[model samples]
Target chain A: MSKSLSYSSITKKIVLSLAGLFLISFLVVHLLINMLILFDDNRELFNAAAHFMATNPLIQVFQYVLFFGFILHIVLGLIIQIQNWLARPVRYNRKGYSELSYFSKFMIHTGAIIFIFLIIHFANFFVIAKFGHIDPITYDSGNTYEDLGLLIIKLFEDGIYVIFYVISILLLGFHLDHGFQSAFQSLGINHSRYTPFIKTFGTLFSAVITLGFISIPLVIYFF
Target chain B: MDLTLKIWRQPSTDEKGKFVDYQVQDISADASFLEMLDVLNEQLVVNDEDPVAFDHDCREGICGACSLYINGRPHGPDKGITTCQMHMRRFKDGETIVIEPWRAKPFPVIKDLMVDRTAFDEIIRAGGYISVGTGGMPDANAIPIPKRDADIAMDAASCIGCGACVAACKNASAMLFVAAKVSQFAMLPQGKVEARERVQNMVSKMDELGFGNCSNTYACEAECPKEISVSHIARMNREFFSSKLISEKEK
Candidate 1:
């Protein structure tokens, strides 16, 4: 940290950005796993994969790292937000102001919505899969495992949960759409020639993530 | 061209302001925006009504004194161009344009479109200068700054302190202004000696002056007539952090 730097603002941003990128990487891994559900003719393969993720020691360690990252990311984001609010301490009452883009102005609002979505997601998937009593399933080899497929079906069967999943995925997509390229710019990766490409890549990635996640619920609900 | 102008008229900083309307007829489209204002003021003087008071010195746009929020933009709709350089042709005939002073708390209205931008002067006094002793001008080649660094430093130095950055900022931050000054000197060999103190003092002063914090919206860069990069803000952060760390270690 530079002595002259206002760490409260800049460091918070750096931390949030790096952690955000880490979480995005985690999301890619997660999306890949969930997409495996689409591949399995039966629910057995998906359940086995879920079982391995839950039981593998190395995977457990990775989960802990992810948990820490989430905590740090959220804490830093909150601190920065509070400090920014404190710094302003007043509001303008002008009727007509201009030059602000719609997306630029609503970052915090979108961020808060995403935060709520994460909490709901964790409760539905992580907590239930890890600690909650799941229905039993017997494999062809006579080994019994927790039925993650049934849990997913139950969660998506409800019309409200389906709506929630779609809304959350959309908000996540919106957040990632802005956050992906913004992180690169903040880290000083700006080369005018490559920025447009990066932005395009970010948009495509966010769209894919959103479409992939939303597909799971949509498939379960309709099928 | 004929135009209807709704100009802000505040008797003083303490008084409530109101928009006074004026119609100007047969103005040249090629006339600069300030020249159009000048013609309006000239007519006002002849009519014995108080002329609209605005600040301008170098009509060439170098002085950073002409600050106007034309139709809600800091320096008007044109990108990388100051108000003095903007011409009347940018507007259609019979258009009603609203002109207001820079609306930041730190930059209080002095009169019509003129503002007391002494906050900038104060931030400079807080340490925007190299503290080297008076001596004969050294040869430019003696410093031997890397070409890349020199170019970056010159880019930062191009900030004209027009208060456009502050006005464009949603939070009305002076970070872009202060960062430009800090980064310009911090980059050069001549400025390296006092880099620590320069950034520290200037930033602290900026905070002290009630300037809002940057939220990374990039509005300042968008509306800046000089187009100073937001990268300078990052450099300012880097300098301030490292300097504070070094001083802490010494302590």
Candidate 2:
């Protein structure tokens, strides 16, 4: 009923795919910065990266863009799904087996899990870092910053949170399994000569992201 | 083959429908699925009962008229074939086959196994054709179409406008149908002239009719009688986006 609903579904899909791809790029940056924690046992390097992310003017602006991207992706995805459900008012008694990809069929379910994970992540880390009080550590030269690295380490040390985080990351992998190349397909970037490669890379990318993020919590908990 | 059958029976579009059980004896395996249904109808007529109503035309598969969700799949279990072309041999003796009409908001069932597919005609009327001035016939080779492009265009053109894609889609999206139409035109020089307007107009009409968005399940492609590629869908997306970008309506 909204003005946006008047736009063609293809237009909505274009917007959704573009927003999703932006968020995918953001995840790459976030994971790389978060990966700093594992390499440096002292936590100095991780804290410095976190400090730069919080204080840098460019990244500060990008933070708002990232938030907007996440909101747009969530809203449009739900809108599309709702419209789709409405399209089929009557349900079939049984569905025949086809070669439909399992992950593609369940994107919304996987996305819902990922969204819940994000909410918990934001509440525990983002809210505390931005709005709530977190104890700060000062360098020898008096450059003071929030000890986000230590906060992360402490949080991951909790067995339950670590387990939840790993499971959530795994679901994120499922979401990405369809989402990565689907973004390209929606954008009309599919090509017979290159689609196979893009699909292969997408699967590899999903695996890497899943393993990389899962390694963070697992390592923090066990080692 | 002796078989048990479960067929949907609806008195009218406004009336509630239900699955009605039927039995057929000694049907020939060589008979087409529609022919088997004809046998059942003959028995119904002999018993003074209402015959099962369904849609079929040019029972040889070229006509996209036949539509029935057999067991669960559109156009029955065999891949890349419509209901009219489906033979009874695909089912084992004594198997119970379930048949239902296509279910979608735009495609309402008029009666048992016969949904009004006029929605498709509506989409076609939107922008499915190219304008050609009345004159002498143009030479076939005048356009100088590349072989690869010609092949792909022919592939796109083969779409029978069957609603199987809609029935197969979880979302009941008509993207594959619209995409096939748009792609067929967009690939050729004659079609290229109106490609921008064609995609935009067709997509707008599709949305107005309340078809769902494509979720990329590829079920539509797998179930398509013509085996239409989803890549045409991607092409339609690209066409729609590029057209909207520079659309005069935006001004």
Candidate 3:
């Protein structure tokens, strides 16, 4: 059967790459804002950054795009994976792991776990900031903002929640390690000169992003 | 040296298959892997049992007919060579080797180890040719093609229609094989006219044949007897994308 013009394998690959990279960029912005916690002793700086992200009109518009990007990336990823699974109906009895990396083979596993974590993340923070009631914190400088930072700190105080957050961050890192370079390859962006660099950058980006996110729950829990 | 083989055997295509253990003794290590199989088949004939069935033509490794998944790798545990080119010396004395046919929905086994690879022919038929008038061969220098393009075209032309790329792939994708054909024609002047339709039709046929998507594992290159580059896959993707866009605008 002829595939639809818009959702062919090539088109799906291109969409996956572009949306994946957009989500990666969002990670950078998110990590930057999140890093404010490490800078100041109190929640004022972090709250100010969070408040800016929550209230800014431009970021708000982009936030919808970011959500759409995530859903698109995820749905396309599942479609490709399902078709891949059906392409080989029979299972290999003595399957070898010689040609594929762990991240490449285990993408679905990591992605599913990450999806659950994302729902929890949005529920705990995003939903509450937008809809649910949150107490206001008054600063000594006569400034008042939502006490979202204190809520985050309290949520991290639970060892289980902190552990869950750290584990999920690590899984996200594993997904990104293969994802960054694979996106470029799927988009037909490849060269002997730059591919190695992209692979290296992928690994480095995964580590930095995971470490940055993990530091938050660890710090808020123990310190 | 004596060797033990755990080879997959199925009575027919519809029935389930299982691994059958057989012993072959005093075979020369210098003999090719297929030659050793020939010895075993001879023994089976003497015992009044049906001999093992596998595919082969031009055992020197050029025809790309011999395909076997030996020890969990396509074309045996060697690099850049077909199963017919693999030597028995790669296996140690008394080693137990596992052999199976290509594992993919598109490649169904015809017998013990021979699979129906007509799906590949269908993909090629979809667009692997340049139409020309029925006349005398064109003059050699009439087209005046660049040397670099010809060389790369020749490189892409190295794919032997062997399904190792599909066998080696975790997803059983034929992207590398399809890509090689697409790139071979896309780089040539004679092929430029049908390049767009060639890639599109071939890709659609490949998809319709139930082949998987490329996940960039590079397994196809590693297992291919021709060592076809994965870059061809990327090039084909670029071609397919541009062709789709152009076709859409034309529509």
Candidate 4:
């Protein structure tokens, strides 16, 4: 009963994991930029960072790369998900299926919500700030479009958008809480002694990402 | 001691199953878990009531026929033991035990706590073998397998093809079981000739049988009676990928 190869299942997992890691790196950079809003009161430095990101030649190139990376990540994630769904077409009807961690079972739901959030996030911040007309603010170097503060304030002022943002951030936390260490394990990094530490690190990273993003709306609404 | 049991009962594979409660009294704490079931069955037979159906063969824990998802954990609360090997002492005097068949879609229940685990057999039939023909026994020392490889093969061979790995997995994945089978054969000299084909065929059969993909949660390893390492899954991935590469090169 010698079997033949269908496809490389691991390749799909590896692709999804690498893409997730890339997105994590993007999160770190994005967080660094957002944290600057806390520092410069006048919004000049924020605008400068925005301008550099939008207009600088190297960053412009990187932006295209990031876009491609995001697309690849989403496509690979969906492919893996579809394959998984096809593999087990039937749903378990029994209760207490959540004996395993609730977060692990709800990954698909969390992932879908995060996907929707990413779309809204890109439309609101990236598209409006990049291509759409926003209020212009004059800086020492030059003039850069700068309505992000106003946009943030307006979005948060609407309680619905605020709620959606909060919920999405929470779901993102849930996704990362599992995804972080899972990606490591998928790449064969599971030493029993190190796995606990890695899981803790993963939890910390999820908390940071969730709290960091949630703070932006809080800062806008409160301050 | 009186024990309350909520056992899942289904007439056939087509009909939906539901939990039915039964009570048994004065059961000894030291009885093996299957013996407790036997006591219940004896009561049923005497009373002329239909006895609860469950799967068990050796009762010594070697045959792997005893499969029960008891109280949210596979094979009761104890680790490193099958359901048949579990003792009644694990439960309190008046405690209630919830028993159900393995809940994977591939392992459909034919009766109370008895599931059709033939999907596993089908997957094994798909590729779990070496094509070498049986002949007279060769020289004892000839074609020696390295100590490490032999040890690993033994570890992999420890799997009993029980559906516990699938039952224990959050995704109901058969990866650990399939990996164990593939690795057991792949480690031996006779199996080397068909290693690539074996992995590929077994994986295809696994997929065709509607077992979910492994999500690397390690739940399979956690609930496995044999404590099969997740590393075997990694090996399966490596073997499958390399086989694909080699096959592509041939093309």
RMSD of each: 3.8, 1.7, 1.8, 3.9
Please report the candidate that would top lDDT against the real structure.
Answer: 2
Q: Write the per-residue lDDT of candidate 1 for residues B1-251, one digit (tens) a residue.
A: 99999899988888777888899999999999999999999999999989998988898878898988888788888989999999999999999988888877778887777889999999999888887778998776876788899899999999999999888777678888998999899898778888888887887787667676666677888888888987788678778767856663453
- lDDT of each structure? 0.80, 0.90, 0.89, 0.80
Over the stretch A1-223, how does candidate 4's per-residue lDDT look in tens digits? 2222233456666667788888888888888787766566667766667767887898888888888877877776666566666544434434434233447666778888888999999898988987888787776667655746556667887878988999999998988888888777666566658878988999999999889988977887777
Q: Measured by TM-score, how close is model 2 to the native structure?
A: 0.96
List the TM-score for candidate 1's chain B. 0.96
Alpha-carbon runs more than 4 Å astray in model 1: A1-7, A52-102, A192-197, B18-20, B42-50, B237-248
Clashing pairs in 3: none
True contacts kept of each: 0.12, 0.81, 0.62, 0.18
lDDT of 2 at B250: 48
* Model 4: pairs clashing at backbone N, Cα or C within 3 Å: A3-B197, A3-B201, A4-B201
Each prediction's DockQ against the real complex: 0.22, 0.76, 0.69, 0.31
> For candidate 1, lDDT tens digit of each residue in A133-223?
9988897878787888877878889999899889878888887887787776555456657877988898899999999999998988888
Per-candidate clashes come to: 13, 0, 0, 3
Alpha-carbon error at A174 in model 3, in Å? 1.4
Q: Which candidate number maximizes DockQ?
A: 2
Off by over 4 Å in 4: A1-12, A56-102, A141-150, A153-163, A192-197, A219-223, B133-149, B186-192, B246-248
Better of 1 and 2 by lDDT: 2
Candidate 2 lDDT over residue span A55-76, tens digit each: 8999999999999999999989
The better candidate by DockQ, 1 or 3, is 3
lDDT of 2 by residue, B21-80 (tens): 999999999999999999999999999999999999899898899999998899999999
